[model samples]
Target: MRADAVSRAVLEQLRELHCLEPEQTVCCALSGGADSVCLLRCLLELRPVLGITITAVHVNHHLRGAESERDRTFCQQLCAGLGVRLAVYDVNPAARAAQEHCSEELAARECRYAAFAQVQADWIATAHTASDNLETAVHRLVRGASLHGLTAIPPKNGRFLRPLLRVTRRQVEQYLESLGQTYVTDSTNLTDAYTRNRIRHQVIPALEQLNPSVERTVSYTLRSLRREDDFLHQQAQAAYAKCHTGKNTLSGLETLHEALQFRCIAMLLEEAGISCEAPLLERLAALARQGGRWNLSGAVYAVGKSGTLTIETVQLPEPLPEAIPLQMGENRLFSGFVLHARLETVSPAENVANIHKKFANACLDYDKIKGEIFLRPRQSGDRMQLSGRGFTSALKKLIQANLPPERRRTAHVLADADGVIFAEGVGCAARVCPDGETRRLLVLEILGKC
Candidate 1:
């Protein structure tokens, strides 16, 4: 019942969160620090009363020399003594940073969260105290953020929980002191080399001079902001549903409030696997209203037309298929389609309307062929005169009209030595159309992957 008791704080948080059910499993992320060690112990103390199982996980980010190993050892020993099952994972943050082309801090965070996801538990808890929230607020504010960013960490994000969010760092250390427990101190935390450490040691203490309970004050303010963010997010979700008229399209976004419009646009971008900044969101909003196109990162394009917006991700052209000789059997092309050619002799007096009707675009006049034929992808400047069409059009145009942006790169082109005989979805060219003069017919069909 003491104010400094972390177990009471965790219990109160669980009661309010409703994230746990009877006999559910809870896993604590044991970082071997005072905060993490204190959290693991408090959950152990509360396990019986809460009717839940307790487990611990340790992620050894091999950043520091021997200190990292020391932390891991401490965690193993601590979990063993507490009689709690533990899972340990080792990750190379430096290697991950180099591979991902990002900072070590971000790489380390990714490594830690990925490790947390592997732990088998109904809820995964981390020891982020009120003090950490204050530091996070300062960090996000310095980096330029909106209401959501300023709100910093939430108490519960999906299966992850921050039970110590309402508790202070001072209480964490005091609770450990109450039990005479010792924890490993990471040397990196004492220095200001990292941005988070700089904010924690410098900016936080500076603000503490004005308000001794600045951490508590920031936590209270952030709690209120989080509630507001949740409300806006719910409203935005409803508006997004109403605006979504079809797949990859959103309509009537211009009719909503500017805030709702932005949120709706955000939902659209998010569904397309795009993470945007404010400027990008603003540009998309403008596109949604005025009708235009914005080139997004990674060959993606956001297009707006007739009050509807959509995203198109341009695909890298598949390797041009090696010209394979078209024969009287099936030829499987690397372009993910099979070209089957069946040869048949036809007399001028033969009634072939049924054959042409059944295989309209798949038949070719074999006598019109000048030389051998091959199956391949469309070439630049390639032109095809489709059957029944009077004029020839660029193969590129036909592909653009018939296939999606992603599939156009892999569109098949069937041709003879003279010119293109047939195109995928465009049918046999006018030069190869079967008629009464046709002496032989080459029935061609393109089948999809088996």
Candidate 2:
């Protein structure tokens, strides 16, 4: 926050990167941390001279319970006090990591980048200092880096810009101190629980003894590595273009250098939404050169024949579960959620219409449903008249209109011998809706992940 004079170095870096164009807007990724606060304030102070607008964005991972809320509230108050537009994104990195089968750290980074992608601005600024750059490089080195992963953090990547790449974390603290700015500290950072925290707490300090300005030195080395990596990437792109014949087909991959071949394979897998280990990559590269079949990630397989390679994803049919009786108490359905069913003694004096509207997708008239009720995935030609909608609509049409595309495959319908009575996403059928005369109610509530 000790901006203006202190921000000259950052301004020069931005100018070199051509990031702060006149009249353009820059959205700062603020986390209510010292580094991010300094970056936001610095950008705000430099806004007038650079002829740019400054805004902020924050993503709350919600992993720290009360601390998460504290960070979010601090970001909001800080943005309001500075009169800057702020955008906030709530992300559950743990859930995303589980779904993607990746580490929570990687998931959080992906979520942050995704949030950055949503901003309607010329540039998205992140508060990554030289210290962070060193830590990232070390962490990647410890794990193993195949390509540009070892190059650590870049000053600019697409629309994302790290203005303080050259600035050290100590300098950030000094800047904020001079301006009397306060920032929140994440409690997790104080512990060495995570791999990154361990590296930051133990490994970096050891290296600092070797060179007092180790962060700066490491940063310079990483910059050079980044340029070399970028050059190789361009070569790989050109090589892929020449070898790529058509969809899922490649020819003359053996002609390219091994590095280019591996890089090309990596690019292809990424495009196909597949991730594999280095050993599998080596095997796949060999398969691409020679003619053979090799099992790849998930249901995907690499097939090479007649001096050509192709990726074939064997999509085994995901058969729906057999229709089951809608029993009382808890029922786990094919939709990966629990449906709690129970009978309640609802009086005629109760606001039946209000109850129907409130739990439209859940409740149904037990008396109206003839025979035993069964739950199954939506079938073709199934139609139902939804309560209050006043029209009979096809189940597929109703699902298309009401449910998100991802949820459509898991949508279920409750049916009896007569017809459909309720849809998972859509409301209950009008014939099964409780009226003012109804004395009992069959309440169905969806308990996700239960």
Candidate 3:
């Protein structure tokens, strides 16, 4: 491909995407690779025609040791030759990956974008060509991407623009050759350790054996897919609004078709600050059809019951507050609530079953109440023989059935050394409740919103 053709393609993309404005500033991500080198040079040459200023920003992810510094030096020299301002950022990708608990590739990308964001430009330009998008599509496909992921990278995302997205990787190298420019090669790109490198080196070459122009074909296909995706997203938004109830929950979501319902469920999960993937969203939608419950991330849960789907955050009581010893007959603050425990004697005329009816206060057999009692947040394995109920059940389930989502995080319970004796919202344990022969009673009252 001719250099002029490559440059023209970039200029056309810039204009078509509305990425350039008169007297605007652009920060080009220069990695000293052929693609970035061609992009920076083309933007500089087109600066006069487009009435835009260009600056080169290079991020050195110090994973390749000395080679990383060489890339940075090459970028500095190239920018100097072109009389362009250059900003260099040295980042340790291994350290960042360890800190963020992510892969090295993800850390490098995050660090690169961080450098771009600090450039103070009207637009941040990345050197993603059509071939790069092809690699991205294949990578996401291997990772089980949905239709939206298969659409690949956008030409312009927020303040970031890809001017060379219409051009192929070969065209970029050809453009640099025509300009007699020198570009540095990263040794890691030749290895197949990374998924993208494997795709570029092995998968793409094998794909080209069948369809030589596969990159361009994928580019065309992505354009159509993106348009369809946009339409579906709009429809999903409308459906979500129609089905949405208060407090980040949705009702009657099962009335819509499965496809639209999935999208609406995804939207609701996102609004509830949950990062749900496609498979998880599908599972949640299936559960919605049958009025079931799913445990979501961050101690949140999704319940689809009685034609109403609700997302709730279960608040667990603090461990410190739960460990504190309780003193009888005095009001004490614990986990933002007031608690008062006292010893009471049963009256001769009083009926034990009638006394247990008061749900807020737990009536326990004083003889069974052994050791120092402490209050704490309900834990995962807590089970109790609930008053009136013959069998024991998980405290989490009882809370889900009774209390709202937000209240779960701070729910408190009274427990002796043996186990939980009583829980807020839930009544006293059947085994520990007062009987007809009981005389002294242990009454634990929890005040304020549970």
Candidate 4:
């Protein structure tokens, strides 16, 4: 194909996908390699026609010694020749790898994206081609990954866009050579230390030998799997919406087919801000079938009568006596409690009535509560009057209303210098309401162990 035709095909794919917008700034992540160089060339040629500005961002991972420095210098010259803005970031990938205790590949990816996000650009573009997708699919399949993993790298993920996903590596190299374009190649990519490299260098070639169109077939399979995966996700979402009652029940999940049940559980765990892994899912499934309870990572699972499943996270313990005071809009971990505070102003149009009823913990009218607020464990003989009822109740009775025994013991209560006003994870008091006419707005927060 002609260089112009190749450029047009790539640009058309991006435009159809709505990856680029008119007059919006785009950052191209240039590594001075063949793929990235070709991508940069194509975007530069399309810039004037599309009326968009392009900036080149090079993240020097400082891993390739002199070759890495050369890559940055080449990118700078390329951007200058094209009259595009160039930004460079130098990061110590080794130190980051050690700190994160992650593989060098993952650390480098994180560092590169962190640098890209720091640049002031609407979108970040990368050169991930069809070959990368094929290799990823094969690798994930070998590792026994689910459909989500087999789907591999998406064409568009978050602010990152891959305009070259539909193009093959051979096509990219040919296009560059036809234009007499010279680009660098990272030597690490040739090494078989990484699973992806092993697939690319060995496994894929063997598969292609069996069938010449294996790469294309794999890509098509991934696309179909992506569609199926998306449909399953939708079904799981519908199931979750139907079954979820307040935040604890697994009713709708148990009703689903086994595949849908696993998907629903994984989705719910993610929604609860808990990360799920293969082992956790297996343990959860085992717990569901064994008619017993098990704890995995951040969640607890219990199987009740008639195959009913209950999933709950352990409540965080109370803050320490020496726990630091939280400031507005700050999140801090004290003892076992996650203390988050935010300040907001109440407007005349905004409804501020009965805000205390929403939270089991105290939502003191910021103006009515005097002195600085403190968060600590419940003290003996701590007492407060429940908001709806006229009679006073002890903290012990208030906690028993609808809370598990283990959670109640660790629950923190909010208080002033006088006494406990609001028991965390329980109920608020009537005396804490803001006087409607005089009170403006105060900071209301939930202090809990996450």
Best by lDDT: 1
Clashing pairs in 2: none
Q: What's the distance in Å from true for residue 55, model 3?
A: 1.5
Can you write out model 1's per-residue Cα lDDT over 172-238, one digit (the tens) per residue?
A: 9989988989999999899989999989888998999999989888889999999998999999999
Candidate 2 per-residue lDDT, tens place, 382-425, comes to 99987667788899999999889977877877899988898887
Local accuracy of candidate 3 as per-residue lDDT tens digits, 1-450: 655898898898899886578999998999999999989988988898999989879898888889988999999988898899998887777889999899999988888777777887898899999999999999998888877888899888999999998889888888888888899999989898888898999999999999999988888898889899889989988988889878778888767887788888888888878887888987787777678878987578898876667888888544544356777875554545777788888777877767677533467887887687777778879988876787889988887787789777666677887888877777677777887877788787777743
TM-score of decoy 2: 0.61
Where does candidate 2 have its weakest 10-residue lDDT segment? Answer: 1-10
lDDT of each: 0.86, 0.85, 0.83, 0.74
TM-score-based ranking: 3, 1, 4, 2
Q: After superposing candidate 4, which stretches have Cα over 4 Å from the reference? A: 278-290, 304-307, 313-450
Best by TM-score: 3
Q: Candidates' TM-scores?
A: 0.66, 0.61, 0.70, 0.66
Candidate 3 or 2, higher lDDT? 2
Backbone clash pairs for candidate 1 read: none
Q: Write the per-residue lDDT of candidate 4 for residues 88-149, one digit (tens) a residue.
A: 99988789999989988899989888888799988888999888999888878877787788
Count of steric clashes across candidates, in order: 0, 0, 7, 1
